[model samples]
Target: MACGEIITEPLMVAAIDLGTTFSSYAFATRGEFKDDPTKISSYAWCTGSQPGLSLKTPTCILFDKVQNFFAFGAEAEDKYTELAQGGGPHTLVLL
Candidate 1:
């Protein structure tokens, strides 16, 4: 492997999208892709304020006062909201 070089090996492929308002991840095995390129699999996120399932979750990160990672995605949104309502100490980063 070298800079700007492409690898042609057959391996599982995964991707993550961190958007301004949302984030998501998906993956597919090489065989699965060979069968159908559109058959990638992704997780469904559940939010307290939203109905049904969401393929993407809010792009947020929660950290404690010490700056240690605590939660991410929908969990981060929920926890940060809870802390805000209760006036608890926490750090929230929205990407």
Candidate 2:
């Protein structure tokens, strides 16, 4: 071990699944994965029109006419719904 040597820490890793109708993310620390590879976490997303959470979110995206990103998942659904009902200006990409 040299006194001038630098120490570096292991970085966390993440996995993302982009499905045709859904999307999800999972992550785990390097040490945690080494100890137990199955130790990963994912978030439960909210489906705007639904009453409960979902394992993953819908693959819907929203943006303004000027190309400004708006939302994703259920939020995008809600925003699109709002635009459709209220006649607002926005673009929705649904899959």
Q: Candidate 2, residues 9-53: lDDT per residue as tens digits?
A: 546877899998889998999889889988987898986888999
Q: Which pairs clash (backbone N, Cα, C closer than 3 Å) in model 2?
A: none
Query: Which runs in model 2 stand beyond 4 Å of their true positions?
Result: 1-10, 87-95
TM-score, per-candidate, Cα-based: 0.75, 0.74
Worst 10-residue stretch by lDDT in candidate 1?
86-95
lDDT tens digits, residue span 1-95, model 1:
68988878758989999898888999999989889988999998897466778899888887776777888888887777777788865466433
Prediction 2 global C-alpha lDDT: 0.80
Candidates in order: C-alpha RMSD to true structure = 3.1, 4.8
Best by lDDT: 1
Task: Give the clash count for each candidate.
Answer: 0, 0
Query: Would you list the C-alpha lDDT of every candidate in the order shown?
Result: 0.81, 0.80
Per-residue error for 38 in candidate 1, Å, reads 2.8
In model 2, the worst 10-residue window by lDDT is 86-95
